[model samples]
Target chain A: MTLDISAIRKEFPILKTSIGKYPLIYFDNGATAQKPQAVIDCINQYYQAENANIHRGVHHLSQLATEKYEAARGVIKSYINAAHDYEVIFTKGTTDGINLVAQSFGKLLQPGDEILISQMEHHSNIVPWQMIAEERGLQLRYIPINERGELDLTTIDELINNNTKIVAITHISNALGTINPIEEIIEKSHKVGAKVLIDAAQSLQHTTVDVQKIDCDFLVFSGHKIFGPTGVGILYGKEDVLNQMPPYQGGGDMIKTVTLEKTTYNNLPHKFEAGTPNIVGGIGLGKAIEWLSQFDLEAIAQYEQELLDYATEKLLKIEGLKIFGTSAKKCATISFLIDNTHPYDVGTLLNQQGIAVRTGHHCTQPIMDFYKIPGTIRASFSFYNTKEEIDLFIGALNKAVMMLK
Target chain B: MTITEKEQGLIDSFSIYDDWMDKYEYIIELGKDLPLISEDQKTDENIIKGCQSTVWLAAEKREDKIIFTADADAIIAKGIIAILIEVMSNESPDTIINAKLDFLKEIGLQEHLSPTRSNGLVAMVKQMKMYALALKMK
Candidate 1:
């Protein structure tokens, strides 16, 4: 099965818009995917017709809004193939989800216990654990990545010992585009009774993510990264695991009873969801997922792989250009640098040509330090992107290099 | 030239290039031609750290006029610094501080000079004024 590239491109209205004199060639999907018209309409309609505070109001709008929001949760639960709908918790984004686990689940760890993360894990995944470790007198360790940006699994035996409490790793490297061997990592970590958290912020849009099949203890992803609205994301944990942890935040909807002295928390998911949620954002995300469910994800992944290969070959032909993250098993993201040129310079010139790409350390400073480079210019592709856009990107990049050099 | 005259000179010079790339070509050349700050001056104290790029600025006053020297690791940032120096360097403390540098917008380079760019140009401009004020007070 093949994806209709043109049809997919048409669904995203922003793709047709121009930036200044040139048409916007968006290659920053790894940062945030452009929204489809369906998702946008869903948000507008929610506010226009069904605006109400959810879970408490006795009004008709509140009941309708609550139904839609919970329905969204069900969609996400099935999307990730979780065991139960109540296991899916809404968050501000991936960063919020990680911090929730670090704060709530960190209570379960004893002093001198260990938390394992990778060198390529985003700062969101690393800093929360570091904070918890520092507060708890726990040891924080890292799994190293080799020259190809693939995790060095040779040391996994020593790393995942009995003291290891949790292994938090990214399913895909946002900077390097390396698809991690997470299934193997999960198996190894669980052998010693350590739970695993998969940062799937970059995976849900590009590949299939199944929580039950992987049997991950916790999985997190942002709604905006998957063509949904911002300010909403999912934290999928096993029902048993989430039940073991305490409620993350305290406020309106997450409680069964509240008193001046003591309070009993609500059930599985609502216990974590505190305060008035982003009601419209959740419904928009549901629409976005429903819109995506029509397409064959496997076919989309295959098409993006071809695009990555084509761009890599063309980019390598340019002299003095070095591509980072050469992992054979990777996504359609590309990070590179030309000679001694700074990424900011190249990125600036590309912007002038209306080619949107990300520059700088990409919030993975440890990975940048590992590569011994300040930063790299990252051009991340999506399913709607094409070879013609890659050609334009290559031309713009050549011009940027010429001007900078 | 007076600061206003210098700004006008830049505006006039940039007006010839209708294309953004051509304007950047001129800016890159100016960046290359910017007077180098002494290696000793490129210390942590002199550095304005931007998330994407770093800029080192040093200044001293001779008579009533202050001379500013700056450099950046990224050429685009350096180019912006060069444009700023062209207007603010060798000017009195009050003139340097009060200068609007509106020529940046007039030349269609305001986006590059925004505080959010985080390339240190914004902080460098403020530091340049601080150096002038300090020298004037002394």
Candidate 2:
């Protein structure tokens, strides 16, 4: 069950490109993953063979289109192990999904209700709630994280109290790579009768998610992070909860019957989905899920964990490189800043040698604020990534540091 | 051609880090060839606010096309203005509208500019396009 990385590498065509006469070593999986050939071909096949509007027509192409679209939904249902396909709503991506919940569910909250979020959420998760809290008079609270980027869950009992209505948190930290105790967070929120929303953008790629098993009221993730096309994602909400909430956008497909008198909305998932959905993207996502299904999850996890351990040990040996988020339960992401070298300069120098690592606040500005530094160069990994790539990256980084000095 | 041989030579020397202070002396040397904006044309309406460096852009119609004249307080900003003028000047409304402006990427300038500076650059480009669009409407 060990991942055949060489075989996997062959599936991605972009890896062939060289930078500065060196082969490209992409360690920026936290931002987005490189798509496999199957996913790319699926997208291409849809455009080539089955280009038609879905769900509204009874013609042959449209019927085929609708069947394929719904089939993708079924794939997603099993991918996340949702109770039913009805729970999975297609979205633009994680940002749109979070915004939908915030706008629709946030409308129901009154002045005294509280919404709790973690300090490590990406701006995508934080800003939507901030907007909702401002519009409605609800108080927004934060579950603080320790120096290691692990949540201080001891205070969770006090944080989720009578007034708490919704608890939204990231399943995995994009900046620090700390995998939050989302199942425990969900349990605590449910105890207070609060619905929970998990941002599974980072976690969905590295780990398996079962929405029914986690019992989270809502879970969202983007497809691009999991080797699918961009501009498509899944928002899985319990059927009852989705039925209760109002429509997020008013447009073409999210309607049953419309009149000037009154407009009746479509069913649970469709109500949230408006306009022309990324039909081609949905097909690509289904192909990506199929690609991932070929591998054993346990094997993937073990290999990734070993890679992380190896990377951590090697990266720490380098002088003046301070690794952030030394938590025990972290994904294969390492964020570190070199002594006296600005992250941008390091990133530029690394790029010259074909080592692509992300260098910035990583859209978690508050985390940067807590550390009192501008940013760090983050190297995130996938199961397909090998130790040799890490060695190349490390060597380039060391050379970058020496050259900068 | 309104541009002097020296100005054309400066535009030819445009590089990615040409905006850096040390590199920008070459741009001020280029600005010496530019026709200064008439004092009467330097009105509030022509001013581009919120830039770190002051920039003024003015437009005139010639042969049913918009001709843009620009000046900036910073030498590099003036170089940016020069770059914009090179791409956009003397072009017809439809031609200006159709141009892809992919040279920004080719020169590797897009990634180096801060978000604010990029936005300012975008605003300048957008303003020039707006002039073309206005001409087309008339």
Candidate 3:
């Protein structure tokens, strides 16, 4: 089924806003996607109607809330094709999920065991591994990226030796928009008996992620980035893998039984999930995934590719605009710099023109270092965004560039 | 001019430009006119780490007057720091210490800046006050 851009845009209230005198042209989807009214209403409906804590209370409201929360787990499990709902653990966000793995699964690693990551990973992916490596006395290895910003996979054989315990990588580069060949990485890593965690923070919104098909041992994504509420994300671990792992945090709802002397953790997913959980946030994420699942993702992807191609062609025609991450397979994100212009200045000028773009190292300082620049002006898109918006962005960016120069 | 008068003058100058383009141009010109910091003064210690831009600020006390110089990697940020230095520099330690940046609000600057740049503005002000507070104790 073909999509209606205007109709879809109408679903988001914030899209109607203006920056100064100009209409808002939001291109910072990489930072966060604008929440659709469906997601917002789901959150509102939770607080307004289904307001109760899950998993503990004997009240009717608590039972309804528990049903809704677990139903969300079922939706997410199907969305990713997880073997069981127990494999999907609710988290604060992608960063929280990564830390959970680094700590819980991390406790299992031994000295001389290595963890492999790519240079394009966000700080969330890098710093946690470093912390755990130091604590566990494990070695850390990096899969270098080529000049095109794609991961150089020729040396995967060298990096994924038998000693490699876990190989963590982003499914798509947040900074460079490089869509990694994770299926290959999973295959190679598995052959050497290594568990792989996919940071799908940038990829989940753009395309479908089938965890079962890919057979990744672990996967992480942010709900907010996928048009859900903030403070909630999903951490999918293989059932067997999670059973072997220890709990990341200690709190209510995560215990089977507790005493002053000892505590036994809860089973499966709840074992990793602690505290009250982001009750409302979980409901919101479920609604978002439900709303998105209705559409043919292939249709949405094709339309988005058109926007990407159109924006790329138009942006390239502008003088002094050099786009980074010229990878053949990428999403609708373009990180670029004007000749001798600071990205901060470019972003500022664009803001005055009512165009919102992200400016900085995008939590990928190593990518910036690779490009030999301080930072880049990143313009990313979602399916609801139109070619018209991209055209306006092109015009505004051109005007901003001319003025800055 | 007194720091207050200098600040008022800046506000009045900014009010002349009806267009944001012209206002930013004026700010850029002001940045160009700032008493630039020397290369040696642009050390890592002097750098005010901003998420959007890198700002380097230098301050010294001659008698009771505080002399300040600053630079930024981004022109817009440089212009912003120029406005701060124009008012706070060459004022007494007591005045600098108690200085209110009401001028930024008055000229619609603080609210106009992106979150990152506004945070950098706060950092610049904080560093200047810290310098004044240290010298006042000495």
Candidate 4:
């Protein structure tokens, strides 16, 4: 591995914490990753030394805070390799980011225009467009998946007609762990004059993201998923698209000028960043990106792929343990169900052994509904997660399955 | 038998286990011995949707008493429901409706069998009581 897994584990205090008698074997990285000391310390240091409202304040502390906050925006912009800093708008997380686009972009759509999403999208991605559809008299389409949990892009021509105004899809299926062919899909949508919004909440943590390369009109991801603080995220929009879209919220900083008679919205990023932003969260996210930038994500991804492969092989050995997403080119998450076993029982059993695996639809109900299962025991891995942990996870899962069955 | 007495009996039975692992095993054993619902009775209408699993519950009134039968796709959930059924089945509608079921806390199964577990415990309890409520109306 390009990164030292043991040393990396030392950076996260929660990883060493014991749950009951057993040391914590955290396999729920898909839900949220444990934060490293650097990100934690960054937030602490911000609160300790630099606690001030940003932008408007001329005081020394406020200036310092504003500089740090805006600098973090630049870091995020470059992190995603967006063409301009203005393209990156700070958001609550992926949900808020997508909602920003849905709400703002919804205003631009005429009746009869369609918003196409995929079967594998999380509820957050699906519901927003559905809301827009309900409000604007627009049609909502689904890009269905094949038996292997991969999107059937071959059917894209039929799905993405001239009526398609926006194609919103996830870069990686949060529930299925399927790495979607986003670039090809983007090209397909663009051919039909549809703006594509990529939900990178799952993929951003696992792989390298270059928004410029993808050329998706908008991209959204959460900081917490990538070893950063919660309540902070990025919504990267193309400069022209963001400018054309109306402000997502009306509050301080979003406006350039306001009056009893009229109000004018602020430029590019600020128009969307309404009210005081998650100041410490922004600073902490910058630190997280800085810490993560240390390793080649390609290397980390390769290592994680190795771990996914190892865990898959071991998990399949357990009788009646069936994996949900068997897409050939998927990332490092395995959603599985033991024959006639409830995921809750298995997950609770794993928790007893201090192995943390998420047991629910993972906010992707349609995928679960598609699989005809309530939920699956999802064991998601990161680069720091080891083959040894996978072994323990497998062993614990086996025991849980035995008891459950 | 009184509901409190039944609850007390459950608490007394579970008090032997010192840890969660042993407690869960006992629950599983109870689940293994549970009389399952028939295929015909395992209809969509009888199913309680859990986020983690599917639970099927059916209730019939045996004269003045309520008889509940349940099965779960997950073993632990089935075991948990089995415990509920063991204590609650064949009880009077009033007794089933009035039972506090605080024995869950006494047995430390509250965390395991969470009432907020809309998919499992809470939904099971609701379905069981609905059966009682329906029978009481009849």
Candidate 5:
């Protein structure tokens, strides 16, 4: 079940574009994935053939859209191996999803109740909880990360107590590429009756997620990061938990009945989806998931692991290049800084050679605070990314470093 | 040589980027065309805060349109300011106030601009619009 890299490369049209006489080498998959023809065509097809609103009119077009939209939900359920379609709630993206939980769940926590979050959580995951904690007078606790960017679960007993209401952590760090042991975290949190939310924004593309096996209370991921359209995401909650939580917003679709006095809420998913959902994006996400499912997940993981190995070896060989987060278990993301060159200058120089990489704090400023650096240049990889692209990236980085020196 | 009507038209039409990949290169070229500001205008009062690159912007009102002058220490930032001025400058105060500058998203230029750069761009635009709004209030 080896991956066919050549065949996969053919699906993304942007790979052919040239920049300054050099072909574009994209290493920014952690920020967002390059869309394949299938996802593109799915979006175009919806606009061309089936451009209509869903769950509204009793007409043929409405029914057709409703069917497609629900089918997409089914696709997501199976993709994550969830037990039911009702458990999957569509969101604007991961940010919106976390905020929804923060606003709703955070309201329920009493004063002095603790909300434990790992230092490696993205700003999207951290800020929402912080805001909630501030508003409700709950204490926000941070789980420390070692120099390797791995969460030090050694102090788990000290962090989780009866007063701890929720534990939020990232499955794979976008900056350090450290893959956190989420199952262990969830199990420990549950022992004290605390709910857990896993930010799977980075891991969803690289690994298969089985919510049942992990037994997390809630999980969130963005669609765009997994070869789907932007502005669409998933928030999965266990039925009992979702059913117990109050609605985050009240609007047309989310309400069963509305009056000036009182409004009855809809069921699990629609209760959270307040306004018109991104119908086209949901369909595109379903298509992207289907396209991704055809490939062998294990092979994809192994190939990316090999690429990470090769990249780490090559980057370490370059003089004065300092790699961040040297963990045993990591995804194919490399965050580094070259000696005496600002990350912005490094990014700009690489762009001239048509090598795309993200530079800066990566929206994890606290992690930057921990590392005591302004920022690092991050090059994240995906399954379709090749070793040649890594070689090109390394070559450009070397040239950039030499010019700066 | 005086700036011509054709040149103004070309600058106006340049707002929408034809392709995103070529935008940085185009911006660098635009930076080359920008007139250098006098040393007097590069004071602390003109400096735009929160930009990774040092950018200084100054504005004046002429013939009911807000005229803006800007310079950046960084070449690409200067080029970006040049493009922004081309679209925003010399328009009626009311027109500038009402103008929906969707050019960045349409041209995919926002994707290349870092969030801080994007915020600085927004701040510049907001400052320009605020000038128009003040004129309208008067």
Candidate 6:
């Protein structure tokens, strides 16, 4: 591998930690990634020297914090290649971003307009649209997936028709690791004059995502999933669309002037940001993205793909083991179930060997229902992971299967 | 044996295995031997939905003692329920309600009993005690 795997693992402090008796082999990057010392130190340094409220204070600390926080927004703008800095709004996480769009931009939809999502969407993406559809008297539809867990785009023309208002889809499936054909989806959605929102919660960490290039109207992702702290995220929208939509929350920072009878909303990003936000989370998210930028994302993507291939090969060797996602394009995640064995039993056994994996429907119950299984044991890898760790995981998985069987 | 005596016996039995895999193997064996609930009793009302697994529990009062039969989709959960049934079944209502079940920790099965694990063991235990309290009132 071109990337030094040993040096990369050293950057994460939790890699050195022991779970019970064994050293931690964290294969749960899909759930949340471990933070590097750089991100951790940046957070600590912020709290130590420059912790203050932003945008409202005129003091020295406030201005410094504001400058840093705004600069962080600029970093995110460039990272996603958004046209304007003000188009990047700070959010709680991906869920919050979707809800913001559903609540605010959703107001523009009339009765009988359709919101098309996918069968592979996480619950966050599904539920918000459902709620908004019910409220606005809009029809909700889903794009189905094939047995390979890839989206079945044959019905795209019928799905994204003239009545379709917005199409919200994940750039990658969190449970199945299917990197979706987002560009194609966006092109089709826009052809029918429908706005598109890309949920990049799983894709942002693994590959490079450019909103401008994709021409998606909106994109959202979480900070913690990208080696940063939790509770902070980004919502990028085209400036014209964001200016057209109403504010999601009405509070101190979101309004330009306040009268009991009538109030005007603030500008683009500030209009959506209402309260005292996660300042530290925002700064840390910026640092996390900066830390990630040091390494070429294309290189990380290649390394992670290699790990996925190696793990998939070793896992398929086990008799009765079936992987859920087998798309030609995939990320470094494998969700599998052994013959007649419950995922929880195998996951628990793997945990005994200190191999951390996610076991459940992964908030994508439709995918599980489509596969006719309750859940699958998912092992997701990162760049820091090595082939040796994959060997250990394979050994542990074999023992788990043997014991369960 | 009384509940406490049965717990001590289980702890003694588990003490024989020094390795983690050995301990899990024994649990798997116990899972194979779990006192399964009747197929008719495996209804919606009896199902406890944990985040990771599904558990079905049935409790009946037989001659002033509570008889518990439980099943879980997951083998580890089934094994844990087997341990619980071994200790808590065929015990007096007052005894079943008051049992602390500390031996689970001593046997390293305590992690399964955690509310986070939610394999339905905790909920099943609480439901068992609730049945006991209801039967006593009756």
Candidate with better DockQ, 5 vs 6: 6
- What tens-digit string does per-residue lDDT give for candidate 2 at A1-405? 677879989999988879757899999999999999899888888888888999878898898888988999999999899999889999989999999999999999999799999889999999999999999999999998889988988888999999999999999999999988899889989988999999999988888998989999999999999999999999999998988898989988899999988999998778888889999888788889888888888788888899899999999998888988889999999999878766765776677688888877889988988888878889999987999999888888887676555
For each candidate, the DockQ is 0.82, 0.05, 0.69, 0.62, 0.09, 0.82
Give stretches of model 4 more than 4 Å off: B32-51, B58-67, B89-99, B113-119, B126-138
* Model 1 C-alpha lDDT versus the unseen true structure: 0.92
Question: Across residues A11-122, which tens digit of lDDT does each residue of candidate 6 receive?
Answer: 9999998878987899999999999999999999999999999998999999999999999999999999999999999999999999999999999999999999999999
> What DockQ number belongs to candidate 4?
0.62
iRMS per model, in Å, is: 1.0, 9.7, 1.5, 2.1, 5.2, 1.1
Model 6 misplacement above 4 A: none
Can you write out model 1's per-residue Cα lDDT over A1-405, one digit (the tens) per residue?
A: 778899889989999988789899999999999999999999999989999999998999999999999999999988999989999999999999999999999999999999999999999999999999999999999999999999998989999999999999999999999999899999999999999999999999998888888989999999999999999998999898999998889998899998999999999789999899999999999899988889999998999999999999999999999999999999999999999689988988999889999998999999999999989999999999999999999999999998888
Give model 2's DockQ, 2 decimals.
Answer: 0.05
The TM-score between candidate 4 and the true structure equals 0.92
lDDT of 3 by residue, A1-405 (tens): 999889999999999999889999989999899999999998989999998999989999999999999999999999999999899999999999999999989999999999999999999999999999999899999999998899998888999999998999999899889899999999999999999999999988889999999999999999999999999999999999999998889999899999999999999888987789999999899999999888889988899889889998998999888999999999888999889688888888889899999998899999888878988999999998888889888888887777777
* Clashing residue pair totals per candidate (backbone < 3 A): 0, 0, 0, 2, 0, 0
Cα error, candidate 2, residue A303 (Å): 1.5
RMSD of each: 1.1, 7.6, 1.3, 2.5, 6.4, 1.3
Candidate 3 per-residue lDDT, tens place, B1-138, comes to 888899899989988887888888888889998889999999999998653688999988898788999888889888888999999999999999899878888777865444455437877888899999888776
- The TM-score of candidate 2 is 0.79
Model 2 ranges with Cα > 4 A deviation: B1-138
lDDT of 5 by residue, A1-405 (tens): 988899999999988889858899999999999899999999998988887888898988888888998999999999898899999999989999999999988877899999999888899999999899989999999899888888988888989899999999999999999999899889989999999999999998999999999999999999999999999999999999988889998887998998899999999889999888999999999999999999999999999999999999999998888888889999999999877776765787788789989988899988889999878899999988888888888888887676555
2 versus 5: better lDDT goes to: 5
Give the Å error, residue A393, model 5: 1.3
Please tell me what DockQ candidate 3 reaches: 0.69
True contacts kept of 5: 0.00
Error of 4 at A176 (Å): 1.7
lDDT of 5 by residue, B38-134 (tens): 6899998778776555678877788777777888766666776787777777777887788666665544456444545533677766767877787
